[model samples]
Target chain A: MNRRSLVTIVSVSALTLTGCGQAGQGDVDNGDGPAEITMWTHSAGNPGELEVYEQIIADFNASQDDYQVVTEAFPQGAYNDAIVAAAAANDLPCLLDMDGPIVPNWAWAGYVQPLGLDPAITDSLLPTAVGIYQDEVYSAGYWDAALAIFARQSVLDDNGIRIPTVDEPWSLDEFDEALSTLQDAGYDTPLDIGAEDAGEWWSYAYSPMLQSAGGDLIDRDTMLTAEGALNGPEAVDFFTWFAGAFEQGWASDSGTIGNEEFNSDEVALSYTGVWNAMDSLDAVGDDLLILPPPDFGTGPAIGGGSWQWGISSTCSSPDGARAYLEFSFADEYITEFADNQVVIPATEGAAEASEHFSSDGDLRPFVELSQRFAVLRPETPAYPVISSTFEKAAKDIMNGADVGSTLDGAVAEIDTNIESNDGYGF
Target chain B: MTTDSLTERVVLRRRKVWSYTAMSALAVIFLFPLVFMVVSSLKPDSQILADIGSPQAFLPVGDISLDNYFGVFDRVPFGRFLFNSVLITVLTVGFGLIVNSMAGFALSRMRWRGRSLVLSLVIATLIVPFETVAVPMVYWVSKLPTLVMEGGMVKYDFGWLNSYHVQIVPFIANAFAIFLFTQYFSTIPKSLDEAARIDGANWFTIYRRIVAPLAGPAFATVAILTFLPAWNQYLWPLMVVQQESLRPVMVGMQYFFQLNTAWGEVMAYTSLITLPILIVFLSFQRAFVSSVAASGVKG
Candidate 1:
């Protein structure tokens, strides 16, 4: 090789080494002066949700110079796993958002610290918006999502079905009659009960129906077992009805979990979240009717909780993280989040400020439904195991397995997992 | 023409036509998915679902626009992600070829103690799944020393949780690549190495001048093999790299799968990422095919 070429190679190698050597230095936290507190969110592609968070971060950054909160967003599907990996590496950020039900598990695992905020800030928020575990607040959410029965008034009127109101929801017999009438009127499947969804939705959406039927995910009094709670007589009856829906062709697990089927006139009703209300409103206009879930034996119920923010236990600057968390709770930001994400605001003031969630708005019914009937899932660290077990058992029952045996198997699995984890700190 | 000659000619013609027809049908079947993806990318979500039951799904006939492509760009940092994937993939492929080939050369050609044991151990690692070792690997990488420039001064730090090197360095020394290289190198005659050494060439010289040049198929096979896993990495990158700018195309796929999935945008993003890989494979089609046919390596 020529001398000039060799010199060129050495120089280029040196420069490349220097560039890589200077690429990434961990941002240190000295507990003083513009601490770069990092935050993570599960909102990578949801532009409407992410835009509100970005504005909040920008405002908080510009408000003061003591701390600068920078955020990273991950897609929701991978967010929990990412957090767990980061925690394993001991590389977790100062602040992060978690699903409501997971806050307990994370707290019990020492991934998150107890969020210490003023009562004035938290007292105004809805109970479901506050993630409390072991009687200590671990996270708080700006918005809460509610489940409702999405229907078209025209379809109900054509089928001679009475329009159910929040004060007096359809009784168990009336609900069955409505489903029968809708099916007899030519709707292929009268209801889309989100049977197609798996994982957490099984416990979140259908367990609420079980609660209304006088059975619970676990005995909340002890928080240690699922034997009697999950496989009791009422629970068996609820599962029987759940399976009969599929057998009788009132609901099917074949369709996509969206408002498309209901909007396209393939189903007369949809049991879905507030996230679908915007599309339903756009498609059905004034004919849309957001009714409460049907009343079983106990009362009408729906699942509660959504994404919430928390401070990591390893955060060096706890006060700075608290400042950002506190700043994010303002009514205006909450209203903006609700307006953008089409969810219920956490506070009445924020609800009043939201365009779609206000008193006279078309989606206002979701707020009342969330207020009256939303039930948080089992708050124990064993909740994840319980959830997956219930999902499997429910799916089996829906597909023709004997309800009694399925429920017994689910209870056995839950009991075994809880015992294996030593009751998961119950 | 004689009657027998005419019959034989006609029979050959009919056989050739039948073969061509079969080939065309197989080609269409293979191309169906690609055609569906490209066509679906131009349509809306509702129309995409609605057309699935009909022949219109395979045709670009309804509610077609560039809206989904635009939505993809708006939703993700497409350029940044693609750049990261290209940078990481190229570096891994380049460094992997050199490292694995040298290791293969030593194992196959060099006479040393514990050589057989070392090759066996290297092959043993192939059975250990990546997911099994991923957690420990993450922990070790987070504690490994790293050089970084801070405040215009060079310094040392630990933890490689979110950088380009974190994604590239862990994947470069692949066991399967080394095994393929060693098997390929063992097939070459040792006489060439002896001849090169008689001319006063050293081990490195023999490796560079004699062995590497004649192992083109192995090199091509290793390059393509390394390029794919490096490009399509999802879980490891999702676990180690938190920065969006450093994410790969596979990890970017999760961005489109939120509660209400944007099906069209997903097809568009997939179509975008698949095009580059398709081009690379097509460019190296001959060598790749020959190498696979010889080595019997299945990806």
Candidate 2:
């Protein structure tokens, strides 16, 4: 090689090496200039929810000189993997949002830390909205979603099936009778149970049915085994009826994932979440009814919780992140999210001011349903595996496999996984 | 006409009809998805779901409009994502062809002590998936040094995160591309190199003049193959590229998958992004076919 070329290469390498500095959330927060606080959200495609967040960020940044919160949005479907990858690179943002049921797993994995907020702030929020892992509040959200049986009053009156209320939801036999009556009344599929959807929707939608049947995902007292709770007699009863619904032609496992069948007058009843309520109301108008789910021996139950915000353990400006979150929980912002996303506001004050979820509002039934029947998913780090296993077993039962054996297999899988992870730090 | 001749013509006509009929059926089998995607893109979500179980899914019948195509822009910055994808894809393919071909030339024409071992190592890397190394690559790239312009001043920055180069750099010099070039270049006789050497041309000149021009089919094949994965990149960019401006088109697909997915918008976005690839494939159809046949026949 030539001497001139060698000298030039050496000089460039030295200059590049000299440029190396530690990469993190900008500069250290040492009472210097406003520290850059990075925040992430799984709200990229959700314009209604994301707009509220962006407004809160803009207001917060303008109100403070000690901190500047910069936000990035990711699609909900791919957000979890992005956070995991960022954590692996030791590059997690200062603040990020996660689905509510996943909080315990992320907490146990050391991906997030407690918010260190006062109890007074959280006490006013909905019980199901806060994510408490190991007695510390790791995350919280502005709203929680509730599920209901959407039906038309005219269809029920025509079929001679009584309308179900939150206080007087249908019993197991009554629900069966109603489905049969609707099917006989010329509805091809009487119910849209959303069985065609994949992944977390399975456990979220069906586990509540099991809970109402007197079965739990795990014993909440010890939070360890799925043995008796998952495969016991109560769970068996629920699975049998679940399978029978398809065989008796009351429901079909073949429909679009959302409110299509119900809106098209093909199904007389739709068991869906609040997000689908607007479309059903538009389709059925004044005849639309939002009825509670059936009570199978126990009271009615619906899945609780939605996306919640939290702080990462590796955050360089933890205080700044906490400040942003605290500033964002005002009642007006909460109401804005509720009105925009068509969800139940997490606080009573927010609900009172909300357009759809308020008193004398069109969608107030969801609030009553959430308060009366909402049940949070099992809070354990083993929930990830448990949820997946339950989905597979439930799907197998729906497809005509033996219900007892499927539940037994699911119990064994969950128990073995918990034992392998040492009870997931119990 | 004689009876035998007339019978022979009848058989020929029947054979021709059967051939065209079979070809049309196969074409429909392949083209059905593209047709459905385009037709569905023109319908509302309710209409799209309603037509799904019938032949109406393949037709733009009732309630057809360009609303979804326009809605895609409101949801996503389609132009920005397209530009990002094009920039990343073009840089990766252009750099990949140059670097891999040079490596192929060195391994094929030049004498070296561990040439075969290096070629074997490059081929072995083809078996290892990119997902396995993604985390380590993200960590290393974050620590890599780069120059950035801030407020009209050139400053040294430490991380490659939230940058375009990170998306472009890590994907260049693919192992499959390198192995392909090596195999393709080996088929070019070394006698060209020897003759160029006797004529006072350097190895690089010999590669540029004699070898590379002859490997046009291989280059086109590599360009097409590399162009695909680079354009369709999702996970790596999702991991490393934090800024929305640097994200590619595949990542934009996730934007339509909210709680209640915008099915019409998804189809519209897909149609827009798939247009470039279909154009690339059509434009290079012959070279792609020739390169695949050439590689397979040689093997």
Candidate 3:
């Protein structure tokens, strides 16, 4: 080819390639009759979950003509980073789902705005399902996930252990005795506390034990510093018992993240989430008992919140986004989501209609636990740092670090991060 | 035979056996993970997890089927992801060859002023990690103008986010690729360029006819190197492309990693994604190895 012809071909190819990236199919305010608003979700691989959202969007679109919602789904693992990058580029969508715990950081970072839904809808929902930061509701979820002690009723009966209830959960001492009994009955590990999985699981699964022992992640009263609450004596006591479980050969951080060990009958109890309840029930039949988490000292506690919906700060049509958000709270959709995803529905009416999470259903115990035992993570922008610091300290403790000094170090790190960001807007 | 000869023969035989044994063991050690991934991909999630503690994990034992592979497709747009990855990798490597080789030619054969300094600066950038400048690059690219088809007329848009060009463009002119090309071209005799120049040839003609044709190993080396990183990109695409249809295979791996992870589906997805790169490497094994050894660039 001649040089000039080659240059022309190359320039044309480059221009064509550049033109291939049409703007994303979202609303551009051209003074149109009906605006098209973009929505983002983190349900890329979850067809069952994404189907529910798509139906809701379709119904919402048909119900009104003022705005038509266009939805995009990203993989759950990559969703937050995409949101952050889009926020940096000022290209955020009109609406998105925020993991309930991270709502504060996003709201504080000005990525999301207060949802401002009606009180009738908000008050009828489970408190744990509401995403509150700084005295204002920023997000709300369709359902909440609760943690439980998954045990086989036949194994408990074979080992002559009492079945614990929500009102009379096993105390720390009784739980210890049950573990010893299960161990004596030839189970190598009596419990799988999911220490094998790192990241937020460390805080979500184990931090509640500290709370049950009369300690908290941070001082909710001030939402500043982890000095007294995190490293207090009760907290240390909880960590000591936590580490002792591994040392005493009753539990170890070597098992898989799910209820695999329990389903395989390798362990007697699985400290896991409601997501695994259906699988364990299938594996063990009617013998599976989704028991409440054992109380350490003060009371039984479980981590609250799941993914919740919110409008972004840069949304062009806040009224349309809020309309979709409010419309999504319908009990029919909530029950559909809860049924499809096997989670505890947020509203009582939804729970009543949900086959799996109704008052007398197979998973009713999870609903009760979520209602009574779920404790929201510290509602401060400093929670991301606090969660990671707590995970590191908890891992170190399980791996044989000195409990007091390790927690003190975590406190130092959390306090440093909090102070660095001016207590993260306390 | 004499006693000394017999003993020496025995000693040499034993040494050969030991060498073979050690090499066989090393081969198995290196091959275990790939074998495990392929074998586990055929099994159900429960069986895969159950066999992890036993030798059965590396073997296709117990209940095995193509269910996970089917599950992978149901979960993700595997074919779309694979196509996106191959297209991006090919374009990046193809355009990269032209751009970097030309840059290499100017730095190596041409006697332009400040060539050494420019080459030095390009090599210096090899130490600056892509992660350190990724956020800044995103911010800059978001502001750069791009031609977008808007209502039947192409117009300029401010951001490059969520586009295929955003993934392909930033990665085309690589520092390591330029350095490899320059080093390889420097080894080729400059007499070829001089002879081509004497034959009524301009610099582009000399570069096209002489240096580029002679730097086959360098091009091969650059192509393989660029293809690997572009194919395996995770973080950059995650930051830029939010649309699922535009996502590559590496990001598709995250689709199978929900709360209740599908281990079998992940392995299946990985195996499917890995097949293309594996096939590419195998088809060009000789060229890839020779190019890497000649250019001193790892594949």
Q: What is the full ranking by DockQ, best candidate first?
A: 3, 1, 2
Q: What order do candidates take by lDDT, descending? A: 3, 1, 2
**Looking at candidate 2, what TM-score does chain B attain?**
0.95
DockQ each? 0.54, 0.35, 0.73
Q: Cα lDDT of all candidates, in order?
A: 0.88, 0.87, 0.89
Model 2 error, position A400 (Å): 1.9
Report residue B238 deviation for candidate 2 (angstroms). 1.3
TM-score of model 3's chain A: 0.98
lDDT by residue for model 2 (B15-65), tens: 999999999999999999999999999999999999988999999999999
After superposing candidate 3 on the true structure, give the runs of residues whose Cα lies further than 4 Å from its correct spot: A1-9, A24-26, A30-33, B1-17
Report residue B254 deviation for candidate 3 (angstroms).
0.6
Residues forming the 10-long window of minimal summed lDDT in candidate 2 chain A = A13-22
Model 3 interface RMSD, one decimal: 1.3
Instruction: Enumerate residue pairs that collide in model 3.
Output: none
Runs off by more than 4 Å, candidate 1: A1-27, A30-32, B1-15
Residue A409 of model 1, lDDT score: 90
